[model samples]
Target chain A: MSAFTRFTPLIQSLPSTIPFVGPEAIERQRGRAIAARIGANESGFGPAESVVQAMREAATGTWKYADPENHDLKQALATRLGVSAANIAIGEGIDGLLGQIVRLVIEPGMPVVTSFGAYPTFNYHVVGHGGRLVTVPYVGDREDLDGLLAAVKKENAPLVYFANPDNPMGSWWPAERIVEFAKALPETTLFILDEAYCETAPAEALPAIDAFIDMPNVVRTRTFSKAYGLAGSRVGYVVTTPGTAQAFDKIRNHFGMNRIGVAAAVAALADRDYLATVTARIAHSRERIAEIAQSNGLSPLVSATNFVAIDCGRDAVYARAIVDTLMSDHGIFIRMPGVAPLNRCIRVSTGPQAEMDLLEAALPNVLAKLAGGQ
Target chain B: MSAFTRFTPLIQSLPSTIPFVGPEAIERQRGRAIAARIGANESGFGPAESVVQAMREAATGTWKYADPENHDLKQALATRLGVSAANIAIGEGIDGLLGQIVRLVIEPGMPVVTSFGAYPTFNYHVVGHGGRLVTVPYVGDREDLDGLLAAVKKENAPLVYFANPDNPMGSWWPAERIVEFAKALPETTLFILDEAYCETAPAEALPAIDAFIDMPNVVRTRTFSKAYGLAGSRVGYVVTTPGTAQAFDKIRNHFGMNRIGVAAAVAALADRDYLATVTARIAHSRERIAEIAQSNGLSPLVSATNFVAIDCGRDAVYARAIVDTLMSDHGIFIRMPGVAPLNRCIRVSTGPQAEMDLLEAALPNVLAKLAGGQ
Candidate 1:
């Protein structure tokens, strides 16, 4: 492979590695269709009907570039969040925003702090920008806020990432504890409090909008991909003080947002009734997933997210076999953590009953095969 | 406005300046609706009915993140372009891809070459990455290809940008000359051949795909946003040698593509008839805009793009006055170049007759007002 010979050393040193293999890729490689698409933590409930209609209507204007300022969307979000539009900066998604954030704060050899097995995409961005990562392990399946703070102080790190209603394990801490963590961090450390799963988590699990709104060092990343059911829309925003949010403008691709995706996000925001109904559906589905895990002789962890992580009471290999068999044998798609300890469990996203029914029917058989193999 | 104190020196020094103000921001700031949105060179013809339908269908799965590998879209694009799937990399749009390309090749203080008064967004990305811009001025209202090649060698620059069927001035070099320019560059200099307008350009103006396929230094960017009438879809791809194309995997947001946008692009590619019809429409609209300009005693440049650049026979002040009056008085939105020489002319995008009718009616009045003010 003869690549361009003049790429920067940092870029040259980087590996062509993706944070996660999407289920669609798996289907392609395996030559089988995914019957239950529950990996990647996307909402299978889909967007509101109004959002779909808005997207369909917006499709006609697909010839025009979306507004570089994202004026209307920012105004709508600001009005809803009770802050000035200047306090919000939108991007393609949280993944894109994380890249921009890493670029802004990290120089070569700079240290970044995160949980040992938090969102891999954030870590990918940090490494892409030549930032060294200092990871603290999860304590009791929840991100260790104290450990993260300790790492930040010890390394004098300029950046740290924490996801509330955490991914993979579906764990969360109370709002006050989260607020305390934010307040306790040194002002030099920029905290990315990712609230991607906020819509599905209990209200008490979320800090109030004003709790850290005055702090320029704290940014809360939110998305429309979960309970709002627009993951494919790729719309996400960062909420912070005006000065902090404006930093995104220094490096972001101003004209990057897709026209229909912005329209879908705006419409999704307007349809609170539909969101409430979908939230109920997601809760019910989570319980059903837990029930499915219990019936398979697995222990499902308590979840504050849109998914359940079931402890298989075995090693990582056994969990991996279950995940592979469920997909290969039954066309039921699921994912698991990449690292040890966490890899002892399998993760499944909440979806419509049809998908849950497929998972329910497939899990027991896959577990039986795994047990027999053991 | 206190910001995080620990931002890198480069980031701290950079200003939060946007390359262009969106029409929506103008509408909000002035408290008036845009009657004719012909400023940004967006296709007012809109996308095909089939593409719209595809987006509508894809919206039902909006809860799932798009394929991280973009496997299906890549296959579709490759099949359409008569290339292997590995020869392409998809992104949010050409603007986003430009950012990635700049990041890959430019380190701090590295010399990056482009034509003066070329694409501002491309320049914006180069500057954001801390690359020193070495500009070659346009000659006779067209990019000076010889000058650009000279500057690349003089500076020993690693990256250079050239847009065929150029923006702002709407001029293009013949395919043979463009291929010659690419071949003449030092092998170490990566060339970005922006063919965003290739779909509408005269066939003789575009090089064959395999012309520079072996160079490993040339990458051509194309977008569905032009003749396909899917600018808002934000679908763009780079065609290059497999090695050069694969470099994008090192840092691109692998799952950044919007699902419906990808569906729309795939559908747009399949509907060749719609693309042909829209191309004719754009060509006709260009002729209409030229006629409108000539009627107003202005000189419209010959264009192979979706927009026309009209010489108003005055300095930048007069051109600026006409543009401001067009918007403030009649809600007709148009734009002009950012630098001198080229800034003496105003740019207008091709649109439906209704928008052209607005432009036709408003231009003479705005020109008269400028004369009256003088």
Candidate 2:
């Protein structure tokens, strides 16, 4: 394959590892319809009707570029969080924001710290920008705050990422411990406290918005993707000091946001009742997912967010077989962690009752087929 | 004003220079509404009714992330462009794609080349990634292709940008000349043939799709933002060799695209009649703008895009005064070139008849006020 010859050495050295293989690709590759569309942590409960209506209403103005400063969404977010608009920054989503954050802080050969099996997207950005990854293992299925802080200190790393109600394991740390971790980190270390799943997590699991309001080194990343069910709308924001938030303006694609998405986010923020109702639905669905996993002879990890991680009581291969078989035979789409022992579990997202019903019916037969194959 | 102390020296040294101050900012600053939003080069004609309907329908699924692979859109672009899917890369918009291109090829101190007053967003990306810009002056109000090629070779610059049916000046080279320039560049220099305005350009001015299909060193960027009237949709793509296109995956936000926007683009592509109708309308708007400029004692440059650049035949200050007065006094929004001598012109985006009428009525008043003030 003849390629552009003069790509920087860093780019030339990078591999094409997309953060997550979307379910659309899976359907294409496997040639199967996904009946239980509960993969990728997407909310099949869908966006609030009000938010959808807002997007539809904004559709006519699709000819106009979104505000480059993202003024309205930031204003709404600032009001909701009780911070000034200058203290917020918005982007395509957490994935895009993570990429920008990496670019802003990590120079070539710099070190970045995260849990070993955390969000692959962040790792991809780190390596893409030539930042070395200094990873610590998850402790008890939750991101090990002590381990992450220690790695940052040991490497004197300038950047660290931690997710509350984390992906894959659906685990979380207490608000106090999270605050402690943030306060303990060096001021030189720019901590990305990704609260993407915070809305679905228990109240105790989330630090108060004011906790890190004054912390210059701490930027808490949140998304409308999970609890608000606007994942594909691609609205995400970060909360930090005005100075740190302003840094995003220095490097962000200012005109990158889609107009309807911004309207959807602003509407999503305003529909607090809908947000509450959907999060309650999400919590109920999480319970349903855990119940289904437990009934299938698997030990489902306790989850604070909108998914349950089932330990299949075997190795990674067994978990992989279950994941593959469920998809191939039953078209029940779910995902697994990238690294073991995290990989000993398959992650299932909470969705509508119909999707849960499909998972409930399919898992037993797939597990039986797997056992018989041996 | 405290910031994360450990941001890279390059990041610390950078100022918060946003690419374009959004009209929203202007409204806030001037305390006035933008009655005619013809700045930003966004199409006021809007997307096809079918496309808008598609977005409205897709809004419910905003709960799901867009396909990371962008399979269907790539397939559609491939079929339309007579290239394999691997030869295409989709991004948020041209601005977003330009940022990625800069990241892929530029490192600190790398001399990136482009027309002196070409796209500021492109320059923003280059400087954001620490690439020093080596600008070639535009000759006769058009991007000087020959000068750009010369600078690319002289600087041994890995990257160069040239836009056809250009923004700010609305000037273009014929297809043969564009292809000749592309073919003439050294194989080591990666050239960005930005064809964002191709949909509105004369047929003879656009190179054949096959012109650089096999040229690994050349990538052409196009957007739905222009003549397609989907600027707020944030859909843009690049056409290049499969090898070169694959490079975007190495660093792109895999799930960055918004779902409804992709659906809208697909719908817009399918509705060929609407595209033709809108382009014709844009052509008419261009003529209207030209007539308006001529009546105001300004020289309007010939255009092959969705806008016209009116030569105010004055210095940058006078042009600045015209732009400001149009916005402040008449609620008319327009933009102008940033650098002299290109700054002698004011760029106006082609829009609906009502917007044109507003400009027709407002321009003489604003210009007369400027003349009287002097």
Task: List model 2 lDDT by residue over A94-138, tens digit each.
Answer: 988998899889988999999999988899999988999999999
Q: Give candidate 1 regions above 4 Å deviation.
A: none
TM-score for chain B of all predictions: 0.99, 0.99
lDDT of 2 at A371: 90
In the predicted model 2, the residue pairs found to clash are: none
Q: How well does candidate 2 reproduce the true complex, by DockQ? A: 0.90
lDDT (0-100) at residue A215 of candidate 1?
97
Question: Chain A TM-scores, all candidates?
Answer: 0.99, 0.99
Model 2 Cα shift for residue B294 (angstroms) = 1.2
TM-score of each prediction: 0.99, 0.99
**Deviation (Å) of A134 in candidate 2:** 1.2
Q: Which parts of model 2 have CA positions greater than 4 angstroms off?
A: none
The pairs that clash in candidate 1 are none
Q: Distance (Å) between predicted and true CA of A56, model 1?
A: 1.4
